[model samples]
Target: MSAFAERKEMIMTKKTAYEFAYITFAMFIISCSIYFFLIPSGIVVGSISGLSMVLNQVINLPISLITFILNIGLLVIGFIFIGKEFGAKTVYTSILLPVFLAIFEKICPLSESLTHNSVYDLVSYTLIIAFGQAMLFNVNASSGGLDIVGKIISKYTHLEIGKALTVCGMITAATSIFVYDISTMIVSLIGTYANGQAVDYFVGGFNKRKRICILSEHYEEIMKYIMEDMNRGVTIYSAVGGFDKTPRIEVVTIMTTSEYKKLLNYLHQSDYKAFVTVSTVNEVIGTWNINKNSRKSKQKEVSVQ
Candidate 1:
């Protein structure tokens, strides 16, 4: 096997390990939200666990058992609608959530509400669940339950994933009325809205990059640094200044936070009078070419400039 191929395999193995760690931690957080906050408060937000809670009231089954059964059913639906890749990742999370819930139930049961206030419990659940959901989404996985529903909604209707989650959650939240008072039901609805917004915020912020456009006489030097040192691609365009009517070369590139900082420092130290505009990009589509290209050479001489 070529050295490059071996390195690629090693990178893929490392990435898979990282993703497993992330999935586990994300499920643990969601479990904490359900067991520590939602269970005692009886707040039904838009989630599989919420649905399980509602069903448990009627069927007299354990909440964890109800959740596991519902997730099993949802997983099949997910496989049919959301694609096999999603179904595979979700299978892990769906099972882990129920298992984690059972573990917490046995080890340290929350016999009573932690905050004793519905609003506090709702907020806690929203914050923790939102963060966990964002992490899963970043890895192209989900926490199962309403996430599968949200994925279906977004895929068919072209609605944003976060909004889809809110829509599905509101429906689940409405079910709270069957089990709780009007006031508690209202709290659930509010919690559902807040949860969607938090998820949107975190999801959008997860892979954010800076889109930078630079107009400078030293465009060649800047572009070279960006390409060679930063391992980033750049696009150059010819432009005429609207006000000054001066011909200028515009260099544009998308950079991660650290790369942007390094470029900023390079410009400052070089004392270049560059006109730079930066915009926060939430996501990048297509090939971004962020990684260094592997060479076929097994061994190469090292040189320090």
Candidate 2:
């Protein structure tokens, strides 16, 4: 094989390994929340697992069985709609979640709330599940439940993942009304809201980037530093100074937090008196750091990776 192909395969293999490692850890976390906290406490956080809990009350099915069956159905839908990478990762995590729950039940079953306080249970489940979901969402994969629905909504309607999840979660929360008491149902709804908020917070922080605009006499030097040294793309725009009407070149680029920090440090050390503006961008669309023609099919949707 060619050297380039060998290197490319190596990189992909490493990335795949990392992705599955992350997926496994994320599933373990979600399963912990569902089996130990959500089940015993009767607090539903509005995912498929949450719905399974309600269904388990009516049918004689275990939560793991309900979740496994529902996830298998959703896996087919997810594989058809979403890209293969996402679908594949979701498959692993979705199956792993139920397996984890089953094992947890066998090894150490909790018949009562770990904290004995519904409020504490609600907080624990919300925080743990949100973090787990955010981790999967960050990798453009989900734990396959209502997450499949949320991802579909996000893909078609262009809604943020958090907002899409909130919509699905509210529906799941409403279902609990029939099975749970008024107080438990109300808590379920609140937990759903908190879950969405926490997911948004984590996803936003994970995907945040800096949109930077720089104007300076040494603009070419700055541009060179960005493109050649940092291996990032920059756009050059011709602009006129508003006050003086003097023509100038502006360098615009988007970078991660660490990249922005490096640029700032470079500027300070070099004593470059550059006019700079920075904005936090929560989402970026289209091709980034890749050839436009290569990603024409994905240009319309947001690139989570």
Candidate 3:
């Protein structure tokens, strides 16, 4: 192989290793929340784990075993319908979660609730599971089961993952009514909502970008710094100040949070009086760093690799 190819392969290998390590730790956190808090308290917060909890009550089977079986079935459906990428991304966490749960169960079995307070326990586990799932989702990985179904919903229906997961959770939470009392079902619904909120809260910051508009007397210097030093694109617009009605140049650019911080620091040092307006950008299209054709060709090359 060429030197470039070898280097690229090494980078990809390192990335994959890091991803698995992170996913493993996230799954372990989820498993601990399940075995320690949720299981003992009978709080079903909607997921394969929640469904397994309900089923285990009726069939008297191990929750870990039930989760394993359900995840396997979901994996098959995901592979056939959702495409190879989704299946491949989910395979590790889907399989590992049940293994972790089983190991935790064997090593440190829970006979009763840890705190003996159902409300606090449910909230604690909700936060823990939500954070773990957020970590997985941030990395474009999932804990599998209904998450695969959520992805299917998002892909075909164009629903957001959080909304799709909420829909799935509602269905699973409804089933909890049969296994537990109405009060338990209410708690499950609240926990489900909290879970979605926590995931959104944590995952939102990771992909969020800033859209910055700078009206500066030294627009040229700012633009030069952005284009040459920061290596980011900028769009200049001719504008008139509403108050003074004077024609001025408005520099606009979109950048990640880190880049925004750097640009803000530069503005403070160089042009402290620059009129800046920053807003959140949910998404960006096209290439930020390279030409369109080059980006398309690079994508194709990466796919081939």
Candidate 4:
């Protein structure tokens, strides 16, 4: 079997209670954000929120009710376009979201405007809710509205996620404009933009992209961190320093960003003269030696010997 297939198999088989907790927490966050912020503002942040706002206006239905009804069709579409894996994960998220929204709405009843200045108030709430919404999605949970719809578009239309989300947001926003207040439309647009940005920002820390760029006299020590401590594969690049003509050893490894930060700090502090540069990598397609057999098998063990 190909190495990629082995990694994929490992990911599929691995299960833990923490994953479930994150998923459920993500669902709850999205639901509460929708109920307290978007619904109260009559604004939509994306495809799902937009649809709920529009449907609620047209039929005078509760936003959560509309979300629940719409998700049924979107879920089917995801199954067709995105496959069973995404669809299966979305199933629990999709159901739990609307349930949380409905329950929160009934219990809290935060719909009454705290201030007459709904525009500013709307934006404030939208930004606040985006925080929670972003956190949930950062952990790979769905928002259960046109959210699944956006994913479906990405799967079937062969579009990138941002483009798919933008397209979905536009359609839903335009549809909503006819029925919602003008201020709501404006807030909806702001919410959509904010939602997208929030996802990109929070997902970085939450998803964990580990990268290392070492600038040090102690090339061996950096390599030790990469091999012994991190136990990840590394690529070494030889570079000449701009001012000194001295050759520098640059080691690059992919791990979680937190891990990367920790390693970077360690290298910098251990060698005060060390200059390190780091980047937030978008993706890292590799494995750490954490499996039962590999737990004690250091990369240094494999490479140094």
Tell me, by TM-score, which candidate is best. 1
Worst 10 residues of 3 by lDDT: 289-298
Q: Which numbered prediction scores highest in lDDT against the true structure?
A: 1
Candidate 4 Cα RMSD (Å): 5.3
What C-alpha lDDT values do all the predictions have?
Answer: 0.84, 0.84, 0.83, 0.64
User: How many clashing pairs per prediction, in order?
Assistant: 0, 0, 0, 2
Task: Judge candidate 2 at residue 221 and give its lDDT.
Answer: 88
What is the Cα-based lDDT of residue 135 in candidate 3?
A: 84
Candidate 3, 1-305: lDDT as tens digits: 85445656676677778888998999999888888888888777888877997899899999979988998899988888877766887998877877998898888888889989988888889888878877887676788988888878877897767777888998898889888899888888888878777766766766579999999999999999997677788999999978989999999999989989999999999999999999997656577734333444455577778
lDDT of 4 by residue, 1-305 (tens): 85545654665455435556777876776666556555555445557656776677779989867876787788787777767766776787767766787787678777475554556555666555556545545544465566676666665786644456666776677676677677767666766665555545555455556466777778787787776676666788999988889977777777776677677677767887777676676654445534523444333244646
Report the backbone clash tally of model 2. Answer: 0
TM-score order, best first, reads 1, 2, 3, 4
**Model 3 spans with C-alpha error above 4 angstroms:** 1-7, 52-66, 106-111, 243-245, 285-305
**Residues 1-305, candidate 2, lDDT per residue (tens digit)?**
85445655666687778889988999999889888787788566677877897899989799879987988888888988998888899878867976898899899977788899888888888889889989999888998889999999999998888889999999998888778788777887888888888888988888889999998889888988887687777999999999999999999999989999999999887746888999999877765645332233233233433
What ranges in model 2 sit over 4 Å off? 53-64, 102-114, 289-305
Model 3 pairs whose backbones collide: none
Worst 10 residues of 1 by lDDT: 296-305
Off by over 4 Å in 4: 1-14, 44-46, 49-69, 105-107, 114-117, 154-163, 181-184, 204-210, 240-248, 268-270, 288-305
